[model samples]
Structures are given as structure tokens and as C-alpha cells.
Target: MTGGAGYIGSHVVRAFQQAGIPPVVLDDLSSGHRGFVPADVPFVHGSILDVPLVARTLAEHDVTGVVHLAGFKYAGVSVDRPLHTYEQNVTGTANLLTAMADQGVEAIVFSSSAAVYGTPDVDLVTEATATTPESPYGESKLIGEWLLRDQGRATGLRHTSLRYFNVVGSGTPDLYDTSPHNLFPLVLDALTQGRTPRINGTDYPTPDGTCVRDYIHVADLADAHVAAARALGEGRTLEPVYNLGSGDGVSVRQIMTAMADATGIAFEPDVAPPRPGDPARIVASGELAARDLGWRMTHTLADMVSSAWEARRAH
Candidate 1:
């Protein structure tokens, strides 16, 4: 797995490890910590853009398939660092794909984002949703999906692209979303640091006057990926694109309420201006995944928030 030391990537690494499949990880640690990775797994502290390093890892490990979760995820930073996001998200994926192909790796599971849908008019988003990325970060992820699809079509490289929503709630004590960009992390940061969690806006079309987002617990997301990989191996050839989420749109206020209920900490959020390119609502349709991969999510908002709080308290 590439970028296996990062937040979501780390959890997926653990999932693979728990399944007794140790994957060689290629991470530059630009935004990941070595401590997050399991000791049994071999770690290569290098960028996937390093063609030689990636190729060597594939060859050395006899890599069969990859779970790719290495990419920028912040919408705000994407505006300031479009080039960086492009290089890291787009170029890096291209390089990794080339290396995988050269090493005879035939299949892969890509970690895409719901940002590819931009702002959907419909509340329930499906794999058939339009591709209109709202930021450079989102654009990069969409490009990666397209690249994966194109490669599969041209080279018989079977692939699955999972577009995840806000991933939170790691069941493990030490596992959670620790990235500065993730919503759950930012909330926890504010609460633990004696600062008020800030809300982006209070005038959205949502019932609570705040933007709504679909959140899938990290563990459930991990399960979905494993199931997707299994589906790949089943020769079902599912055209490789599925939206992984709770399929329930929860608003900002709803999250605060859940967090407060979970941690007994009053998250008095300071309302602020809207993010540059945020969507008002994004709910996913995991029905396709359920039908194709026999996958189902296991965590609700309350469950996710409470489990996240448990992980956060430990930190």
C-alpha cells in the first residue's frame, strides 16, 4: 500500500495486517508518522513518485495488488497549493501505477473522495453521479480514478475506485484520523486544546442551517475496502467504482451534538464564513457496493462520534 502511514492509509494497513497479509508500505512521511504503522509491516520511507523506489518495492515484495490511499485531502490547502496537490496526487499516482504495471501487479483498490461530485443537487449520490470536482484536491482524486479506469481498460488491469466520505471513528485506541485536514480531527484538536470548535457556516439549506456531510467510520471503511478487493478477486469485474459512506447526511450541528453526547464536552462552535468550495450536502449510495461486494456499513453518527471520542480521549 502507498502512503500507508497516513490516517486512513494506516487503518487500512492495520486491516490488511489483521487479515495476516503484511503489505510493504511506501510513504515519504511528509504528513505521516512512522509510529502509526505496525511493526511487522516493512516500511519504505520514500515518495511513490520515486519511480525506482516504487518499482523496487513491488519487485521485492512480489506485490499482487495495491490499496492506494496516498493523496492530498484538504480543500482549502488545494487552493493555495494546487501545484503541490497536482504533483503529489496526480503525478504520484501516475508514477505508482507505472511501477505497479512494470512489476506485473494486475489489480488495485484506489481511495477516491466524495469531493469528485462537487455539489450534488440530489441528496443521495451514487457512482453514476456527475464528475465535477470542486477543488484541485478533488480534481486530482478524480483524475486518479480516471487514470485507473483507463489503465484497466487498456491493459486488463482490474481495479476498484472507492469514493469515501468523511472517515472517522477508529475502534482501536491508537487509531483515528489524526490529519489536520479531516473534520473529526479538527474538532478534537479544538476540544483538547481548549479552543472552541469552529463551524464553517450557519446558513446552509440543511435543517440545522449548516452544511451536511456523509461520514463513514474508519473501521467500516476498512471493511468496505477489504470487501472491494475480494470482489476484484472474484472475477466479477465491477467496473471498479463505488461510493463508500454512511448514506446518511449529517449536518455540522448534528456532529457537534453527537460529539457533545459522546465526550460530555460542550462543543460550543464559533460560526464562520463558508469554505471556498464546500458542498452543501453530500450523501452517498452504498447500495451498489452492497449488491456487488456484499458490503455493509456498521456505524451510525452516534456510534462514530462516540468511538471517535474514545480514540480522541486516549490521545
Candidate 2:
């Protein structure tokens, strides 16, 4: 698995191990932690941009398939760093595909994003949702999906991309989202550091006047990747892309409430002006993934909040 040391990728590594599939990790550690990958798993400390290095890793490890999750993932930051985002997400994917083809690797599972849909018009987004990405990060992810599709057609590569929504919580106490731009870490970090968490806005048209998003536990999301990889390895036809989401929406205020309850720190978030282009709501239907990959939201809102808190405290 590429990026097997990242927050999501680390969980995916564990899932693959649980399924009795030994995984070799190749990570640049730009944002990923070297400690996140297990000590037993083979680790290749390098960039996918290095075509020769990637090809060598595939050949040396006897890799049969790949679960790709490495990229510049901050949507808002991506707006200011478009070139960097494209290089890491778009060019990186292209290079990985090139290396795979060279090494005769036939299958792959891509890590896509809900950002590909931007602000959807409907209440529940599905795989059929038209992609209208608004940032470089989103656009790059969409382009990465395109690269996979084109490669699959050209080389007969077996592949699938899982479009992730707001992934949160923890599968293990040792692993959690550590991105400086992510919501959970921002809020949890503020509270732990004796600073009050702040909400961007409370004036949206939504019921709670806060932006609503579909949040899925990271562990459950990781499991979906394993299922996709297994299906592809077993020669079963899978959809080109699947949205790994919960059909329900959770507002920022609701999340704050849950955070307070989870951490035993009751404090109202300081309200700030709304961020530009902030969407009122974005939820998704995971039916397609459930039908094919046994996708399901096994954790509840409480489970998400509490598990995240526990993990945050452990760190």
C-alpha cells in the first residue's frame, strides 16, 4: 500500500493484515508518520514520484496490487497551493500507475474524496453524482480517478476508487487524523491545549445554522478498501468508484456538543465569519459500496466521538 503510514492508510494496513494479506508500505512521510506503520510490515521510505523507486519496490516486494492513499489532502490549503496539489496527487498517481505497469502489477484500490462532488445539489449523494470539484485537491483526486480509469482500459488493470466523505474517529487508539487542517484534530487540539474550539459560522440555512457533512469512522472506511482489494484480487468485477459514506448528515454544532460530552469539557465554540464557499450540507448514499464491498457504518455518532477522544487522549 502506498502511503501506508498516513492516518487512513495506517488503518488500511491493519485491515489488510487482519484479512491475512501481508502488505508492503511505500511512503514519503510528507504528512504521514513513520511510526504509524507496524514494525513488522516492510517499509519503503521514498516518493511515488520516483518512478524507478516505485517500480523497484513493486518488484522487490512481489506486490500483486496496490491501495493508493498518498496525496496532498487539505482542500482549503490546496486552493492556495494548486501546483503542489496537482504534482502530489495527479503526477504522483500517474507515476505510480507507470511503475505498476512496468512491474506487471494488475490491480489497485484508489483513495478518492467527497471533494470531487464539491457542494452537491441533492441531500444524499450517490456514485452517480456528477463531479464538480471546486479546489485543486478535489480536482486532483478526480483527475487521479481518471488516470486509473484510463490505465485500466489501456493495460486491462483491475482497479477501483473509493470516494471518502468526512472520515473521522479511530480504529485504534494509536492512530488518528493528525492533519493541522482537519476538523477533528483542530477541535481536539484546541481543547487539549486550553484553547476554545472555534466554529467558522452559525448562519447557514441549515437547521443548526452550521455546515453539515457526512462523517464516517476511519476504521469502517479502511475496511471498505480491504473489501475492494479482495474483490479485485479474486477477479470479481467492481465499480470504478464507490462513495464510502453514511447517508446521514451531522452539523458542526452537533459535533461540538458531542466533543464536549466526549472530552468532559463543556464550552461553546467561538463563532467566526463563514469561510468562503462553505456548503450548507453534503451527505451521501453508500448503497453501491454496500452492495459490492459490504460497506456499512458500524459505528454510531457516540462511538465516533468517544473513540476519537480516547485516541486523542492517548496521543
Q: Give a tens-digit lDDT track for model 2, residues 1-315.
A: 999999999999999999999999999999899999999999999998999999999999899999999998999899899999999999999999999999999999999999999888998899998999999999999999999999989999999999988889999899988888788889999999999999898999999899999999999988899899999999999999998888887999999999999999989899999998888899998899999988898998888989999999997
lDDT of 1 by residue, 1-315 (tens): 887888778888888777766678889888888988988889989997899889999999888888888877787799899999999999999999999888988889999988888888788999888888878999999999989989988999889899887888886878767776678878877887888888998988888899988888888888777777767766666856888866777899999888778878876889999986666888898888888877788778888888888888887
lDDT of 2 at 105: 97
Highest lDDT against the true fold, candidate: 2
Worst 10 residues of 1 by lDDT: 231-240
Off by over 4 Å in 1: 273-277
| Candidate 1: residue pairs that collide | none
For each candidate, what TM-score against the reference?
0.94, 0.97
Candidate 1, number of clashes? 0
Global lDDT of each model?
Answer: 0.84, 0.93
Best by TM-score: 2
